[model samples]
Target: MTTTLTRPGALAASGHPLVRPQAARHLTDEQIAELGVELDAIRDDILAKRGATDAAYIRRVIKVQRGLEFAGRGALLFGRNKAAWIAGTTMLSFAKILENMEIGHNVLHGQWDWMRDPDIHSTTWEWDFVTPARSWQHTHNDLHHRWTNVVGKDRDVGYNLLRMDADQPWKPFNLGNPLYNAMLAPVFEWGIALYDLELPEYNEGLKSKADLKRDLKAVGIKAVKQFTKDYAATPAVAMLTGSGKQALYGTLVANAVRNVWAHAVIFCGHFPDGTDTFTEENVEGETRGDWYVRQMIGSANISGSKLMHLMTGNLSHQVEHHCFPDLPSNRYAEVAVRVREICLRYGLPYTTGPLPKQVASTWAKVFKLALPGKGHFRKGKPASA
Candidate 1:
């Protein structure tokens, strides 16, 4: 096989937003090869584990789900109470969110093999955990990776209402109230569906709009069927079904809690008040490496407990995950050391740590931006790590 590949030429652009803040920091061809080898090995481990996903891992996943549902239910039922129990829950739901953001959504887009099998390399799998490869893959892989923060090209710039760019001002969302915006984000897991799924499906380059229309129509049918089944069975639905009363009853309780935990876990990562949320344009001129570095810095990591970071896969270490996404998250703390060295070399902030620290940092930004004359673009100035 012969291929003449060319880098996007990000480093060469002296005007790149990242060039000044970051010096000429790059992996040597050889160094990159070594890292590739390291990642390949980790993929093997992941695969082996998957092969043995046996009763134990399955049980653990189930147990994790059970706990997640419980916490989620508590949050839904006792809204404020669930928030109070934030410290009580494990990292399972949190991991699920990042997993959904990066893994589930994109893997759904069609990169499951690469995620499970480390031997292939046609598609980029390293950052697939955060950037996604499906609908998101287009933004991160084609747009963000190539344009790296460019205004129009990098689809990551919108806030559904607020422009992340200082140059533009357009209210994109109807955030009814301040508290609603703050508190409701967790339950709205559909934020992903809205941004990645809906936006593209309705607008953008819908290659064959007619084809998409047909597909959507089919999907609508499936949704209706599922809804009909649920309505016939659930107490909440307008059309309640009278099926295996015991099983139906149990499912309702289990499902309600499961979804809440799943959403809460994910909501905690980026939805907190303080994390940086900017337009793609502000950082457009930045290098991919710098944008890569910033995503880590701008986003706050919960740095949940070791078991949490471990089982949840260091979603708390969002910075590390973005810095060297391919590296096994177990090595996130270790790789974070290297990333910190790079940040120091480049004078960039290395944002990360445990959940309490993450929560504090997140809300600090929220409160800061909430204050008059404070919002930076829309995010307020960067916070200390």
Candidate 2:
């Protein structure tokens, strides 16, 4: 997926690396402690804010935010079709992008909740449907923060078989090749149900009972059953009546698009072939902080426009994201500066190519890791010991 993106709009300029590559290593414990201070400040703000009210002043704030997002696309969005949107931005679907930034990512990271409601704890295990938020917590917090691509258990590294880096066998494949699924990523959320959230908990849950696997399996079954019911309801939406159907259809279609969209972005993050997935034995048993450093080393941050950065929720800044999971996502541009310093300090491989480069790299990772070859047969023994 190496690209010669020296053209305009590319993250490269002439000969220098885009965005000034820099990185650091061995931050004093003081640095880590400082992050805790930052968290406390954010927590205090959340405690002071009041609830969302119809007549509240913050409604104005939310409205202003919406206006910013609406004008961002430069179109009046009142049930207009794609043809109407064509009159505005030419580069991307501004509405979906706005939704991702304004609604999806914030909810995923619980930014709105963070500074408004003090009680809501944004655990990686719950909340935020878009951007595969739980997956972010697991991939960023559990895997990157805790293990950071340590291979066997880190959970971020994929690309060895047809499965996603963090996928588990759902149904039988072809005994061998069949057990592995290919690029289920794009539409995996609809079909795989709670696979994203469930896998992390199952792998990293508290010390468990004798029937832990059985309990986990029950969750998986329930997730699929619910997803299937929802999927089947999509097309039948037109059949629903009254305002009830109108609301349901609108919600259903919006979610269908966003859920699928989130998976596509996330899958390309690391499941592709060129990305490396080092096991525990290879990287050694790294400490928690080392894992954060390693995830930045292995991950690439795809560059996009300012609006693209926000609407897409700085996912384009993938490296910064995988590094700082707790920071308000809006601040990635600021933290990214320090990341550049760190990369240079450690002589680490910090990849932050443009979108084209990121996509190409991910495509390569998919084929290289997913193609079943040599003794790639499944054990065929059901989920048993």
Candidate 3:
């Protein structure tokens, strides 16, 4: 059976807030209650601010994304012009990133539910991803955000391929994970598309073959639509105009850039050095306050400028986002300040660092955990590995 406890005592006080020791340890019930109340206040304040301003923000972002996409595709028709190819691919990449992160992710999270706009609502909005939005919402929003870092419950830990936690049984196959992780970056969406089918469940007899087949069909449909748009039709148009080869190459490159960047931003959120993973038992009888505390310790955040935050779809505030997944995306930065103050008052570790450092740390973790003798050993406590 999997262990059911959180080993907070294992953490050591690193200088960075990202690795501050024992952020969640030794909190009395009273303290947990107090923190919970304060957190609710922060959530409520952000909720209240979700009005015309938030609506306008999302609309404007969508407008910008559409414009960039149009211009990028138009420029790509100039195909063989090296400068146009470079500029168009870059613009397309940025457009894809904005659509996936700011628009698709947040919108599908129901962050814009208050607007009551069906066109933009989670129910109606499909993204450029190969994974159907319904499947993604279920796996990501319902499962991932709900479970956060609980070892057995959250498939997101290493995403069913990498052994993220050292305690996970290591096999010789894992030795190639460094390479696997690297390759995964450029094709991350494809990996996720396959994963969203939950094939493991069907193999384990937890899900039926019929259900898996249906899901696979859905994925195939989405994949065909995506590929036709990006790979076939767009380039075919250019080809007819004598720029086919360049458009094809440019779109492929742009997709690679968007995929890898998204992978990096997402990996930096959960797998970085200071982030904690929990045993399923740790959440037994968990309260809302306990859930909030779990999210705080289990997720790490990226520290960066406003543009960086926007580019990341404000997922730079991953901790804040996990804490209130349904909250308006734009409000996370504001809530983060209040959250840090609460963390200070309650002596919680508010883990955050610059983007480069965080991404590097996460990669270091991937490499280290791949070899897998043990994970970071904490002082005086049983090694989590």
Give Cα distance to truth, residue 373, candidate 2, Å.
6.7
| Predicted candidate 2 versus true structure: per-residue lDDT over 233-349, tens digit per residue | 422432442223333333345445555556556655554333344433323423333445445655667667886576556776667766554445556676677676655655555
TM-score of 2: 0.55
lDDT of 1 by residue, 1-385 (tens): 1011123334446563422222123444344334435433543554454433333433354355457545543333222233423422323244344434334433333323434444223253332121223344544444443443344554544334323333333332322324444543543433433454444535666546775555445444544554454324232331132223433333344333434444434434544543444444335344334445445445445655666654444556655544444333344565556655655654445555556565555445434433344344334222220
Model 3, 306-360: lDDT tens per residue? 9999999899999998888778888999889988887788877778999999988
Number of the predicted model whose lDDT against the real structure is largest: 3
* Highest TM-score scorer: 3
Name every residue pair that clashes in candidate 3: 4-281
RMSD of each: 8.9, 12.7, 6.2
TM-score of each predicted structure versus truth: 0.55, 0.55, 0.92
- Provide backbone clash counts, one per model: 26, 22, 1
Question: Where does model 1 exceed 4 Å of error?
Answer: 1-186, 198-208, 211-288, 310-313, 326-331, 360-374, 377-385
Q: Rank by lDDT, descending?
A: 3, 2, 1
Candidate 2: where is the Cα deviation over 4 Å? Answer: 1-140, 159-183, 197-256, 272-274, 282-289, 372-385
Candidate 2 vs candidate 3: the TM-score winner is 3
C-alpha lDDT score of every prediction, in listed order: 0.41, 0.44, 0.81
Q: How many residue-pair clashes does candidate 2 contain?
A: 22
